[model samples]
Target: MNTEEFNNKFDEGQSMVDDLDLSKALRSEQQLTRISIDFPV
Candidate 1:
């Protein structure tokens, strides 16, 4: 990829990483479940 394309992708990935939230969502039973990270390296 060209420099600009690489930079754009890098910036987008950085933004997504920065915006990640690790808090568990509560159900009616109030159980804490783990979040899945499915990204491939």
Candidate 2:
């Protein structure tokens, strides 16, 4: 969909998931990582 249609849908409070490719989408400035930590007394 063009930007105008997408914007209209968003402004109308409609769900936009069906028109989006979320697999490659990420929130701005966010990083995902898996970490492991060990501590010994």
Candidate 3:
């Protein structure tokens, strides 16, 4: 493939990684809320 195609693919992969990171962070926050509610402080 060409340089442009490689750069596009790399950008897409980075975007996917960012999306996955955000999803994981959200899920973690939700789980923490649930745990705090269930256990109390």
Q: Best-fitting candidate, measured by lDDT? A: 2
Ranking by TM-score: 2, 3, 1
Across 10-33, the per-residue lDDT of candidate 3 in tens digits comes to 877754453244553553445533
Against the unseen true structure, what C-alpha lDDT does each candidate score?
0.64, 0.93, 0.56
Q: Arrange candidates by lDDT, highest first: which order?
A: 2, 1, 3
Candidate 2 Cα misplacement greater than 4 A, ranges: 28-41
Model 3 lDDT on a 0 to 1 scale: 0.56
Model 3 per-residue lDDT at 38: 61
As for model 1, its CA RMSD to the true structure in angstroms is: 16.5
Alpha-carbon runs more than 4 Å astray in model 1:
14-41
Candidate 3, superposed: residue stretches over 4 Å from native: 14-41
- Give all TM-scores, in the order shown: 0.32, 0.59, 0.32
